[model samples]
Target: MFGWLRRKFGKTDRFARLDATQFPRFAPGTVWLVGAGPGAPGLISLLGYYGLGEADTIVYDALVGPDLLAMANPRAEMIYAGKRGGKPSPKQADITLTLIEHARAGKKVLRLKGGDPMMFGRGGEEALALARESIGFRIVPGITAGVGGLAYAGIPVTHRDTNHAVIFLTGHDEKGGVPQAVDWPAVSTAAPVIVMYMAIKHLGSIAEKLVAAGRSPEDRLAVVSNATLPSQSVVETTLADASTLAARTDIPTPAIVVVGPVSRYRQTLDWYTGGENALG
Candidate 1:
């Protein structure tokens, strides 16, 4: 089956040369939850690439890149299940039902999410739904934006010289407000580095909370937008002025906000900037 796909596409690059047999089959009547990686289609794993070629139905999220979608079988059914903040989106339950519906029909279903499906992407919720219905599914991990996106901005989540601990959290809860469960004061002090997803909306309040919780106002931070893609842009600022700077700047969503000393390292390691510092 794999050989036939390669021949049909008439491509012999490294991706096409991969032995699909080495990976789990995207069998019929099963759903595969695959991550498309940050913003780079090339970052997708070989198993994820194989699933794209075999799936009869692909249910993808907002952040999944067009390049990855284009790799799907030309004849495959495409379903949009993207959920963006402050935008009208599909209900999570409905998406789960859609996956179940396709799988029950004996179709090879692909649930392709942007970034790691389990990392703030709601893969666990969908996976639980599949389990409750006795549906067979597989997980294909991808590079999460918290790490990959930061790397694109030349920010490391951790460094030997810097602190060892890091924390990843969402900017909002299910209600689209600051998460009350998180002890902001404790987190501000405990975690040496913090990476926030979907936090742009509440950045002002979050920064205030962090500041009141003992974090230094002068702490370095960066906001990386369109990470790993051609239109990628990064904004560097201090925690004291993160909210003000972000509002004034056009750095768009699907962005990652990184706060820590590691942000300063971007000046030295920003490979994307051609030896120039990415700090703004």
Candidate 2:
């Protein structure tokens, strides 16, 4: 099942050298929620790798890449509970129920999610449901796309020269519309940089709100798609034109949108597949 390890490490027991005690066993009857990291399999944490190798069942989200899934024990039960906006997806409650059912049956259950499990991925909700059922669980954090994806796009979330403070926000609410709770006036001037997750769908409305709340319409914004993967693409625009630019059907999803001067850093720090983080 861990054939990748043999292919990569060539039979070296690296774990033994690094202290085997640090790599904890994936005990049966406990559920582990692990972030698979933005779209790349290699970004998965060590604990995540261990959990995959030992898990009896893996309940994975839509954004979790197939490469990461290929690392799991071949005999493990794989459940797809991916939630794509506006698509037919499994209900959250039912997915949690699956974890509880698997754990109660004395199986090593793993919840594989994209980005940080707790960052807009609904990992907290699932964990709460598991706790209510008295099912033991662990959280293995990974690089969130809001942070890692921007880095791949060569845009810093925060820079000493530009923004000293930053805000992370989800673009939509339970109804899948622009978040009504965001205090537009307060947040518009609150942080130097604002990173929005899943906001592309409602960018036109959101941009209007921010501009009305004192944010400059000409503020820089970049949309990073399929982050950290070879297929990744960056679209740069001003907040004034963000809606019109994102309106193109070609722009990919599972994207992170950044608003601020941080995106301008791509001119220098960009190391990923890039020509220019500028609008064509």
Candidate 3:
């Protein structure tokens, strides 16, 4: 079954050549929730790659890279179910229903999401929906942008000399506003490093909250845009100036915001922009 895939995509540098049978089969009438990783197609897992090759229908998000999508069987049907903040996107209910409908039709449905499906990608909700409907499903984890994207930007989420703990949180709640449940003061003080996903839209407000919570105005912060992709860009700034600096830059969304001293390590670890340094 993997002979064709090995013949076609096995020579890629990022993925080691291996038998496709090692991965889970994309059974008929079942949905596979896969993470495409940040934006780099090569970051997709071996299982995810196999699912792409076998899926009969692919329901993908806005952040899934084109190269990854191109790996799907040409005869497969592609459906766009992207959800962007403040933009017109398919309703979550509708997307879940689409997955169920396609699976019920005896098609091998692949719900390809950007980043780790379970990590802020709404994979839980979708999985729950499939469970309620008694649909068989499998999860193929992908590198989430929060960590992988930051790595691509040369920012380590953790460094022994800098931090021992990290916190990951989304910037907005369901209503497209700053999350109200988070204890801003505790987050500001306790977490040595904070990695925020989908926080660019409300960055200014979030920054303000952090500042009011006792985080220093000059705390190092880095905003990595289009992370892990060739078009990626990193903006280094401080907590107080993050909103102003980001506003003046052309960095695009689907970005990750990292806070802490670990961001400073980018100066020596920026492999994409800077040559290899002694740090790594």
Q: Which stretches of candidate 1 lie over 4 Å from their true place?
A: 4-9, 13-16, 276-280
What TM-score, computed on C-alpha atoms, does each candidate reach? 0.94, 0.93, 0.93
Report the candidate with higher lDDT, 1 versus 3. Answer: 1
RMSD of each: 2.4, 3.0, 2.6
Q: For model 1, what is the alpha-carbon lDDT of residue 152? A: 80
Per-candidate local distance difference test = 0.88, 0.89, 0.88
Instruction: List model 2 lDDT by residue over 156-232, tens digit each.
Output: 89899998999999999988988989898998999989999999899888998999999999999999999998889
Tell me how candidate 3 scores on lDDT. Answer: 0.88
Worst 10 residues of 3 by lDDT: 12-21
Error of 1 at 21 (Å): 4.2
